[model samples]
Target: MLKVQEIRELIKLIDQSSIDEFTYESDGTTVSMKKSNTAPQVVREAVINTPVQTTDTKLVKPEPVIEARKEVDMEKENQKTEQENTSISSYDHEIVSPMVGTFYSSPTPESDPFVSIGSNVQKDTIVCIVEAMKLFNEIEAEVSGEIVEILVDNGELVEYGQPLFRVKTK
Candidate 1:
């Protein structure tokens, strides 16, 4: 049976490599780990080897492991559907997230939002906050414009360069 550290090392190895799934077994003991879009999915089975404890064939997963770091966007079909869902297209510009993080429209949940639809903003205007790894980062508009649409919901997860807002230039 692999020790805890050995299992962690195997998970790390799987995550770093392009392999989507990994499995290992020895002396009637088996373990497997897999990575998905949201989190690591581990399916564990009890192994009865030597003097080890008896177990059952079951799936056991640890706490949400760090997800594979990458940017995810709408698929071609989703883009088409969203475009059709849009009522109007005043999308002259976009305020995109600079990094992958959790987006917060307001400083705090109780506070008023930084900006809203039709809110006029300057190039340096703060539009939202993106928190990454416990670090809160203020996202700037970087373009003078009127906010035509809010692309992402408050507290929604965002990817690097993901569109957060659609703006119409002043």
Candidate 2:
């Protein structure tokens, strides 16, 4: 039987890839998963075949608990962004993420961050790292500027083209 964590990992991998369906069967147990582009949902069905009886279980990805937590987190983030936008100037340049990945402020957790608010940066300065598919990509400042805001928290999951930092250009 596959663990819940393992199933969740498989769901994430499939969602990121081009595949839309997957199945696994072994030892009288079968696991099947399907993804629909039109809907943001994943359906998983597990079946246990026994000599005398059969058992079936249906599990959906983004369970209610997870969905509710995500909603709350998004609400808080939206509020924070609204306050931040009030202080952001029209001339500020946004440094955006190049790919979908986990954001890291520092090369290593124990070390200081590559850049912080008020830090002066050159166009080529390393500002942070984005880890995607086991690859650690160094993100550059891309503009000569002073860091005005860090849009994402450390270790947060960021989407492609998401703004990572707000810079006041020189």
Choose the strongest candidate by TM-score: 2
Off by over 4 Å in 1: 1-89
Candidate 2's residue-wise lDDT over 1-170, tens digit each?
67767866876687678887887766544555666634334333434332332255544333121111111233576788998778675337999999999999999999999999999999999999999999999999989989988889999999999999999899
lDDT agreement of model 1 with the native: 0.79
The CA lDDT at 16 in model 1 is 78
* Candidate No. with top lDDT: 1
How well does each candidate superpose onto the true structure, as a TM-score?
Answer: 0.51, 0.52
Candidate 2 Cα lDDT to native: 0.77
Per-residue lDDT over 54-158 for candidate 1, one digit per residue giving the tens place of the 0 to 100 score: 377554543332322222232654777787567356667889999999999999999999999989999999999999999999989999989988989998999
Q: How many backbone clashes does candidate 1 have?
A: 0
